[model samples]
Target: MSDALEKAEQAAREAATDTAAVQIALAALELAKAAQQQPAPQHHQCDHQHKPRRSAGEWIGIACAVCVGGAGIAFASLALAILGGTAAIVVLVLRSMWTDVQKRR
Candidate 1:
């Protein structure tokens, strides 16, 4: 009877040791996976320089677009009004580019 009891006690100790080892191995695997999955840190640089100013023509273009949109809504043909406004904006952009080219020359 005593021999049987000693064998059982040894078996229990071995099982406990195996469980602890398995738990430790699982923890280490999880830690390794987490480290591998981490994203690299991002570095951002701040600019303190002054922003470029928009020319008066650009402001006028914006104002004309808003006014045209309002008139289109009032006339109950919003689509046509929006199309006209877009065309006007394109012309204004082209004119500004032409002026810039002239200035350079």
Candidate 2:
């Protein structure tokens, strides 16, 4: 009778342990499913607002004005100053356009 009682108690302990393990596994599985169903967090751009870049023509006009002003101040002859200023403006415009084209590629 003592031997039979000991065997029964040992079996009960093993059954309790197995039941606890199964319950833990089920809880972990439920947590995993919930995590999977949740949507991932979305990231946004920095504080700076998105602004359109200056058009090529606008950039050219601005560059030309600056160049002409600087050339007029530096040169003695108006004709020579104007010519140099125009050349500088053309170069700036061409360079700007080239860069824009390269960026598109």
Candidate 3:
């Protein structure tokens, strides 16, 4: 009689384990369905507003700035030319001094 009871208890334990596995599989299926039903995330776009055209006064200001910039660039070129000429003159004078010293030697 004891042996029969032990067998029955073991069978009950196995059935319980099988029921838990079924419950877990059902829960997983439910999760998969919920995931598939979810809506895709939407991207929000900003409405681009065009900037107004520049006024006549702004145009005149831009032109003045361009003229001033051109004048500044011209003056910088003239300064660089003057510096190059001065450097050439100094080099020539030094070369002449060196030749004179060699002749005296």
Winning candidate number (TM-score)? 3
Each candidate structure's TM-score, on Cα atoms with residue i matched to residue i, is 0.40, 0.44, 0.53
lDDT of 3 by residue, 1-105 (tens): 999999999999999999999999999999999998999887986699779999999999999999999999999999999999999999999999999999999
CA displacement after TM-score superposition, residue 52 of candidate 3 (Å) = 1.7
Pick by lDDT: 2 or 3, better one: 3
**CA displacement after TM-score superposition, residue 22 of candidate 3 (Å):** 78
Q: Write the per-residue lDDT of candidate 1 for residues 19-39, one digit (tens) a residue.
A: 999999999999999998998
What's each prediction's clash count? Answer: 0, 0, 0
How far in Å is the alpha carbon of 21 misplaced in model 2? 0.6
Compared with the true structure, model 2 gives a TM-score of 0.44
After best superposition, candidate 1 residue 44: deviation in angstroms?
Answer: 3.6
Clashing residue pairs for model 3: none
As a whole number from 0 to 100, the lDDT of residue 91 in candidate 3 is 100
Task: Summarize candidate 2's per-residue lDDT along 5-95 as a digit string, tens digits.
Answer: 9999999999999999999999999999999999999897599887999999999999999999898867757778789999999999999
Better of 1 and 3 by lDDT: 3
Off by over 4 Å in 1: 46-105
**Which regions in candidate 3 have their CA more than 4 angstroms from the true location?**
1-46
Question: Which structure is stronger by TM-score: 1 or 2?
Answer: 2
Evaluate residue 74 in candidate 2 and report its C-alpha lDDT on the 0 to 100 scale.
72
**What lDDT score belongs to each candidate, Candidate 1 first?**
0.94, 0.95, 0.98
